[model samples]
Target: MLFKNIVTIAASAAIASAEDVYLTVKSDDSSINGNVLGFPHEGAGLNYFFLGTGSATAFTYDESAKEISYPFAGSYTQFFTVFDNFVAFSVASANTEITFEDNVLALNGSTSNFYACKDTNDPYSYSTRSYELMWYASDAPSGCLPLTLVNSGSAAASSSALPSSTSASSAAPSASTYEGSAVKYAPAGAAALLAGAAAALI
Candidate 1:
């Protein structure tokens, strides 16, 4: 009976801790390299939202639940769409190889790594189409252009934009208007229960 009770208590604690993990992603790469959106063609300006240091974007996920919520601005040209800068991901567990379609992203050490992928069909189709993807570990060929990493805004702000862009060639999006800094795994009542149980043990 004692062993079963201990297991139950341990499981509860694990659940509580796992519910508190979240991620904050802001636009960091804004250079003239392959990493920047629309590279080798027209520069989206220095402070461009997608390529330049424009705004901060954030994503929150619950490891235990596998639930993710992200917000970003959509393209300026597409007035009807919103949240255009959203990216899709496939992650099973922590420390496991996580894969994101189109772009590459991983929590490398302390800094989160991200790679921008160009559209499948290029407008100009330059001789070396490898520069479409930007980042150090980009899957692009060896001769492809390299991306230059830079710092973005300190905090993300909410904009009334949407995620709709299929490729980097589209005009960069505006920041999302939903400003959520953190994520919660459990409800307010769950925290209360955990606190009460911890106090009883004390």
Candidate 2:
């Protein structure tokens, strides 16, 4: 009886703590990567709400419950990511891996490791054409073009503007007018309960 009561109380404490975990996306870009949206792309975000150095562009992330939100298919032209600095395991268990290009992610030491993966969500493979997926283990690849993912943005050249001249060429993440934040997923109050219990008891 004593053991069961202890378990019940321990579980409650765990739930409380897990409810509190959230991530703050910080841009590692030294210079603000301004987009066509007329706002800088250098900050932590999902779609619109961004956090920049100090509080210039700071806003709450547009996070929802129990779903990891994907940025609009077309948002960024080219965005930045850090390699091997620190790997923090995801707090939102709803999405185990983050989607950057085709890659899935895993927590690697203090550095969160990201790699290339084919889009499972798409009806067909997004990388079936000219592009190749990359996995940056310790650092960005040597002797390769500086790596950044391209997204759809107002600052980006129009579809008509994409070069017919070469398939290899692509634009960087474009500067754009800052819209409001895109809706993103967060853990549920229930998931928080489960995670919190696991955390405290473990």
Q: Which candidate leads in lDDT? A: 1
Q: What is the per-residue lDDT of model 2 for residues 133-158, given as tens digits with 9 covering 90 to 100?
A: 23355564333222232222222222
**185: Cα error in model 2, Å:** 16
Once fitted onto the true fold, the runs of candidate 2 whose alpha carbons sit more than 4 angstroms away are 30-106, 112-135, 139-202
lDDT of 2 at 116: 29
Worst 10 residues of 1 by lDDT: 75-84
Model 2 per-residue lDDT at 131 = 19
TM-score of every model? Answer: 0.30, 0.25
lDDT of 1 by residue, 1-202 (tens): 9999999998997567332221222333332222122112111111111232223333343344334332221211111111122122211122233223222333232123244444424333322223233333335433333332332223331222423222121212223221111111111222332243232122
Q: What is the lDDT of residue 4 in candidate 1?
A: 100
Per-candidate Cα lDDT values, in order, are 0.28, 0.24
Clashes of 2: 33
TM-score of 2: 0.25
